[model samples]
Target: YYAEMTLVPVLNYLDIVGTVKRHLLGPRARNQVDMDFYFKGSAFYLADLYTGMSKVVFLCFWYASIIPAVYFLTAATLMVHYISYKFAILRSYRAGPKLGAELAIFGRVYIFPLAVFFLFMQADYNWSSFPFDNVCETNSTKVTDSYIGSHNLQYEYRDKDGGETNFLDNIKYPVEISEGDSYFKFCNQDMYNHSPKVFPAFPFFQDDESKWMSDDQAVFSWVFSILVIVVLTLVVNSILVRRLGASILSYFKASYKPQAITINQRFSEQSEISAYVPMKCDPSFLFPLLLCDISDIDTELIGWEDARNKYDSHNLSTDVIDEMKEDNEDAKCYCILKHFPPKKND
Candidate 1:
């Protein structure tokens, strides 16, 4: 059970990678196993998504009560990703973009936190079931001992037959119980006390279970930790995707520079124009194209020095800028406000 919980994700990931390679590289590479690229990509990603969802459901075996808010949120996230990828595959997504490399990347990155999440879930579920045994009897001299209490009793394992064995050197803490009629026998160590009254003590002697965390606390801690990881993953991925997409678009934009210049030259010949740089001009001049659906303010315009100058002259209150930043840390509003100081003329 322990090994399964630990190893299943790794195995699944390997399978997904193998499937992706086969799908992209063709049958000859994978021992004559032919598979469609779209089919393989969708299948593997959907499988991972299913496995993640199943892990959430698997937690129910340990916690049958009302599900934690985190559980619902996590499950919903997995579902959303599944639906999105499936929708893309069925409708809009093209396998030629990266030949299933994108799926493999997502599968590799997502499985890490997912694996950790399951580990926490399994550990939380089986926490109470951990092997523990209380000391039946002990005869050490001191009032408190390491295993039991300090008292004058020597401990030994007694068998069913009239034979006793003292293998104290071999045994470690948290002693393992042997099979058959094996029982612990404690003899009085103190010569003065001929008839010693041994006390039934605990295995690990310190009697404060209060120091341990309750199930609710453990659940919340685990859930909260997983939640933090999920949030960070989302935020970081969003930033990376945004930046990478921007770079790619920029490269493509550079590629069209010559064509744009040629079109502008033709337009200038037909009509009098001051600036013939179509790509560099304001978007309004370009056409009605929406790069971002955020208000009328183009996100690209935010990068323009002229627009930033205009914004600075507006003299928007610090409270307003602070409020925007407070609303969304990743909005980039804070960064724009920070870098573009308000015009002194205002």
Candidate 2:
């Protein structure tokens, strides 16, 4: 009910969006950035962080195959994060929503490791009747006396003679069978009457029936060892993948390096800087205008008094002139260009 009512609608919506996208851009083209549109302009930092942390917790718990506490916590955290993200998406960005094909690919990739973890859990069950201290479905119920010749009923047989006999080697019954000493010497009719004609095969060594390891023996120790190894493998693989991906991206000029900086001093000075620029000239060339020192002389503001014999004069046709410096202190250094049209040639 949960999947049909909730997930079906979501999948339908995605399908509809995908159909629309295919109509716009040909089906051959993949829309990788479509899903990003929802979070593009939103304040999704907290939601995104929590969502990723929830997945990490889930993966840890799944790989460990330990207690259920972490799984429950991760589930609750994921639910809260999903709700938080949905709220933010509804109220945040104004961009048109897009559904991306990468969503399905990412979902499958994330689930692949979990599937392996589950398969290992299944294998653990088949390994032994008592794989751990806690009893599982395989070992929940012990064999009853009603079923004779079963391995679980081994204690019922008495070992009479110290001699060993191979029953499968001969058609005649061994003499130890009537003596009631040989546990393996079961009556043909009784053996056929056992609930399961064939028993599950053991994967490990099958030296003697008494030599097998019970599920209760060192179960937690083995589980912990497996968990540690799996987690270590995952961490190492993640680090290698990150480094490899960065190296690959470097070829496309997409890789970045992080740098740290310290602010040694902080000061603020209010100032105004403005300039008249021709539209044809690029703005990049005008960057020096903002860096001009405030102490530089402005040729346009110089009057006759400021220019009076304090500066050497030079006649120039252009209204713009280069700044000049004076060696003497208290002597103003400035530039004055001859006005345009030379005062109408009067």
Candidate 3:
């Protein structure tokens, strides 16, 4: 889904009927100044793109260990993202809205690490539940306990060995006291609950039915150890991935680099700067003029020096140009914006 959302926009360079876009909303395409007024592409949403990719990242990390084939699917999805976004962001989209570094940085720093921890927990559980020649469904009460999470509501003194159980009518749910020690604990539950199955998962070294992990053991300490191990793994993996991923991207996406400011031709102040440009040499400014009924405009006053209509539009452009600049100092530097009238029809 993430890959699909990403690729669709990049590929949708042409609105064939040319009606989806409006003039004032979203980022403008590079050549939109020449395209039909309603045909320009929409702005790429970096935040939404990040959210979608993060969903894939989190899901991949959580389930990859349980089903090893998920590794390939995740790889394929991300690979699609890599190739599509690489081309689209450069060639298809505009320079785009400026975003903070933390927009991308937070997922790697916090989200990925937590995802890795979840991955470890899943991996540990799956590794232990192996050699599964014998498989059977758990009890219907537990299976049907979807919307009403049963295990969370139950209170008991025994180790969490309660397996899937039938919902006997008004029967007090049996709670395990010890290893398979099944008996009803008179707790004020709704007589329906999810009894946890005794799977030989983490924090318990299974010897026999003689012992189990209950509230008496140092469970927090063991959990702390697991967290430490997960952090260490993330640190090591991050170091390795940084070097390897850089080489990988460099190979596949040769143009992927720090978006450096590279100006091939610098602006010339004395010769090139101008408040107005004629349509004979440059026709780009004429695009805006075409949107209005220009037949009534005084054609003679367009380039005349007496054209006190110094600017147009929502009264902003002419004000700045006509303002008293900085207490009458020699105005050596100013933003030499292209002199174009704002859309009067908007």
Candidate 4:
């Protein structure tokens, strides 16, 4: 999977699509093609390449616990992405789009947390289900040495005939087992012959009674991993949005640059007037957009009601007139804002 992702893109660098197209359409079609076809570089898209990189990176991290060598594959994938992208951009593709750290920011803010979580969960699962006869035994010195949480015992698989039992290595954590949850009352001579559920703690739960009796480690590993990932993801993204501030819209460089140039061009000739007679707050809070649909639940808890007002419930005709007037209005209110230069505009 990793090799294909890194190598297949090189085919684009060689323009296999073009070769197949030219050959399939016959030699006559090649002569009739556009004059710029041979001279112009193939139209390469950076966004697709970046997306593939993120996917393969996430894949590697997800499976690295099972196969440690996947880490090396991830490095190779990144190297190929960088080398092929830079080389193709220079030698074959047309000028790529001017951009900022948006894609880089996306991978950081979204993919890394998810990938890390999968890595942790897989590692935990491997330890929990380790097939070898491992862990502290009840009769061993390790059990008497530490806290109950630190000590665990696994069932022996050897039988009387000297045959191998090969039992699953499940840790037996010391916990209170009352008559209702006791192993002898629930377990039978043939407990292993049939399904584990026929034994006690049969509330049809995944574990016999609960995970402690069967596999205590499986359930907690993935759930806590998710919660940890959630907290970290929230903290990182919160920092991102907070730093962006109200100028988030300014990152729309394709739209922003032209407007900035036109505004500067128009205002260059006008010198002063204290920026016109009226400089008001624009009643920003009363705008329809600010009148968000807040639920009573939110109002009771968050106490945003002092600011929120219900839109007028006037007749349909009134709303129609309001909508028409809104559409007809040809004025824009400026907030004396400044525009920043787009990153790496070339």
Identify the candidate with maximal TM-score: 4
- For residue 63, what is the lDDT in candidate 1? 48
Candidate 3 whole-model C-alpha lDDT, 0 to 1? 0.47
User: Candidate 2 residues 16-135, lDDT tens each?
Assistant: 443453454443344533433322342223334434643555454453444445456546555654564465445442333234555445444455455454434433433332333332
In model 4, the Cα lDDT at residue 56 comes to 80
> How high is the CA lDDT of each candidate model?
0.40, 0.38, 0.47, 0.47
Of the candidates numbered 1 and 2, which has the greater TM-score value?
A: 2
Error of 3 at 249 (Å): 35
Instruction: Please give each candidate's TM-score.
Output: 0.21, 0.24, 0.40, 0.41
Position 314, candidate 2: lDDT: 23
On the 0 to 100 scale, the lDDT of residue 120 in model 4 is 62
lDDT of 2: 0.38
lDDT of 3 by residue, 1-346 (tens): 4556455444644422332344333236456444433333344678766776777777787677657777777777777776666666664553454477877787776667667776665555544433332232222323222343323233334335866554435435542223332222222111011134332244454333323334433364255446547665776677557656766778778756577687664333233333332222122332222112223344332432213233243122233343456552322223232333435563
Better of 3 and 4 by TM-score: 4
Error of 1 at 335 (Å): 67
